[model samples]
Target: MDSSNWAEHLKQDFSKIRLRMLEKLEEFSILRLNPKHFYSIKVEQESSLSPLAELASINLESARMLHIKPYVVSQKSLHEIEKAIKKAKPNVTINSKDNELICSIPEPTAEIREEKIKSSKQVVEEARIALRTKRQDLLKKFKNWYPSENELHSNKNSLEKEISRYLSEIESEWTNKEKEFRQLK
Candidate 1:
């Protein structure tokens, strides 16, 4: 590997780290009533169980309400959706009205919000660890290429800067998510 390639290489790695961080952040359910969460359930079809998201359109009717309307509205489909949602989220209130299932998500308790905040902090800590690991990998690789103490120290400083920047980014993301979680009703 050429010495000049470090910048580009680390840039790509940081991008991947950032992407993974964002993906993990999306799993913070307390932050919002994400429609994607409902898609994870499987509803019974004619012969087999299929992804509910594939058969129906999940719309966020409000912050705490979800309207799941199947493409082909029928008693069978409606029952299947209600069953699936109940199975996955027992606390959710399912009401069949018109041609859609109106799901009312229960409000999270104070303890639940605290638990989610703790988990979010853990995720941020994990991302920081991952960044440190990447920094170490770069330092090991630079060992074979760097010729003098000056170049070695220069690269270490660069890695530290990247780490600091990413840590800040992770913290900021978590802080914003925490605010959202606190606002949940």
Candidate 2:
């Protein structure tokens, strides 16, 4: 109702937007395979899902190689881990030897690279839609909170500016990821 309360409300809304943006970025990150990406993979367990990292120890053997050894050594557990990796469909060759699984991440082909870029663009667009929805919700809240037309107009301008800044930041993040994906070998 007051100026201070409105400012605080705006701050909370901005923080929520930033948090959602970060979550979207994290989701995008998992779509690509890096040394750390393996950790994001989840395996089905009875009635729950568990992260691959929790079930297995993934060691980076080289820049393009990973050695995964499950802590609970069993035929079924190993098979489940292997199945999870295959389901992820990462550009990697999986070989089971002894009790460990060796993952060989090869350089992306031209077609593969193109596909990844396209997928990244789709993800960026989805993030933009989410951000736009959040902006609209904020505008609705502003309308309900601010009764004066002049004050509402001023707040709308500032909110639009903030939204533009966040959208640019999201674009920059996607660009950096695209560059990284392109440079992979």
lDDT of each: 0.82, 0.75
| Backbone collisions counted per model | 0, 0
How well does candidate 1 match the true structure in TM-score terms?
Answer: 0.90
- After the best TM-score superposition of candidate 1, give how far the Cα of residue 9 lies from its true spot, in angstroms: 2.9
Which candidate achieves the best lDDT against the true structure? 1
Worst 10-residue lDDT window for candidate 2 reads 25-34
Q: Which sections of candidate 1 miss by over 4 Å?
A: none
List the candidate 2 regions with Cα displacement exceeding 4 Å. Answer: 1-55, 72-91, 96-99
Q: Could you tell me the C-alpha RMSD of candidate 2 in Å?
A: 4.4
Per-residue CA lDDT of candidate 2, range 63-175, in tens? 56788999998888888888988888555789999999988866657786787678667767877787788778778887787899998999889878877887888788878
Give the least accurate 10-residue stretch of model 1, judged by summed lDDT: 25-34
The digit string of per-residue lDDT tens for model 1 on 80-181 reads 899999998777788999999998867888898788888877877888888788788888988888979999889878878877887788788878877877
